[model samples]
Target chain A: MITRVDHIGIACRDLAASIAFYERTYGFSVFHQEVNEQQGVKEAMLRINGTDDGGSTYLQLLEPLHAESPIAKFLERNGEGVHHVAFGTADVVAETEAITGTGVRALYEQPRHGTFGSSINFLHPKDCQGILTELVQSPVHE
Target chain B: MITRVDHIGIACRDLAASIAFYERTYGFSVFHQEVNEQQGVKEAMLRINGTDDGGSTYLQLLEPLHAESPIAKFLERNGEGVHHVAFGTADVVAETEAITGTGVRALYEQPRHGTFGSSINFLHPKDCQGILTELVQSPVHE
Candidate 1:
């Protein structure tokens, strides 16, 4: 079983520029912004209109802050915009097992730390239908 | 102004296999499925939970039935899972104009035929931050 959308991840070369764009153009407000050194990314969570308290889904803007970061490579090859969609899952291992049983590849052999303190794993885009799928298991509440 | 998520596009290599995975694992039901010869894609709509009926949010699974399809190229470069996130806008023309003014390239200069017959325009991923974005305007009277 799965819950709602956790976050929509976007890879950007400049967080400030993209942040300004969403704020000025769409009125989306940044709820939280942090740098995950482990993941080599600086991310900002922008709440969608009318969901400021994290009650509704949010936009995650990721800026690689480093040269060799995967985000940078992604930008170099694909350019900017929708990177991945993180979905809330009841059980990451079970869901991943289910997916792998179908002979699809999981990005991580096991679960890994995700953006915003969420436990997440990326299902290989090849395993999925061409979209990079993130399986997120959030804290039992919220 | 924006409402909520319109849908996430998933580019699949196999329409039938992806459909079965989403339906069985995620509990999504098919809203609509079709083959668009011009687009070179076979698309299937999966209703994301909590957004049913005229629900604005859903997932569009797209399989490049032809090798020359753009979706096919996306698959070749990026693999699969989540392609783009569509946002529901109050005014498509206004939004398109605003975004275009910001230097974000629109796949089409104007809204065009979309899944489920919605008026939609795609923003070039290059300008937005490595993530593909879509703007959707529903025909249903508000």
Candidate 2:
């Protein structure tokens, strides 16, 4: 069901500052950047190493666009830190159905738009041992 | 400095249960399991996607060996969830020196023995935007 460990999302107070820290400290370069009003997050995807393998992973830095955004609320409760771990999937709908069939809940009834035109749905953290998990089906997969 | 996102350390209450959950829910299988007394953790590394790429990622499920273990203390305070994010490096010593040179503190003055003969060191979370970061030099790299 899962293809790879897609990305780890990190919530930050400032997008540019966090980006600078990762780039300077770990030599990561931002591969893509976008703002999603629906999610209320300004995000940057940093490629970990220069690999372009089918399973290339990333560190996603997220800053809230508003106080009402989920990322903002997460920062308020947990401070700046990891927000979620996303797994790459070839078919998120099937994967969601298969997992939720086992009684675990999905955050959405249908897959939602994610970064880089990916389709994503989240698994409830309570059921995932306190770790919020996202299943992402990239545009290539679709 | 860093080669890849090596693994995400998830602090779990029970090693077997967590292993079963990941294997059953996400089709992940345990690739390696070890007990590290120095780290006070019984850990299982589940290979994500079975890619075997140079940058193959993993979900590291960690269970505390004793009540005084750092993982146990983390569970008592934060419950079961991600404990740290490890980045792969060819030379942990050089990576530690470079990162700490920027004023970020490494948890150990020297690299310590890690799972599977990897040398590892941790960075202070306070300086990493509240994310506990680990630098791992795998035996292959060493």
TM per candidate: 0.80, 0.96
Task: Find the 10 residues in a row with the least total lDDT in model 1 chain B.
Answer: B47-56
Candidate number of the best DockQ: 2
lDDT, each prediction: 0.75, 0.89
Task: For candidate 1, give the lDDT of residue A29.
Answer: 81
lDDT of 1 by residue, B1-142 (tens): 6667777888877888888988765667798888877678899977654432234466889999778998999888867766777888868888889878877889987688777667888887766655678888877612
Best by TM-score: 2
Best by lDDT: 2
The DockQ value obtained for model 2 is 0.60
Scored by lDDT, model 1 comes in at 0.75
Residues A4-59, candidate 1, lDDT per residue (tens digit)?
66678888878999899888766678998999887789999886533222235668
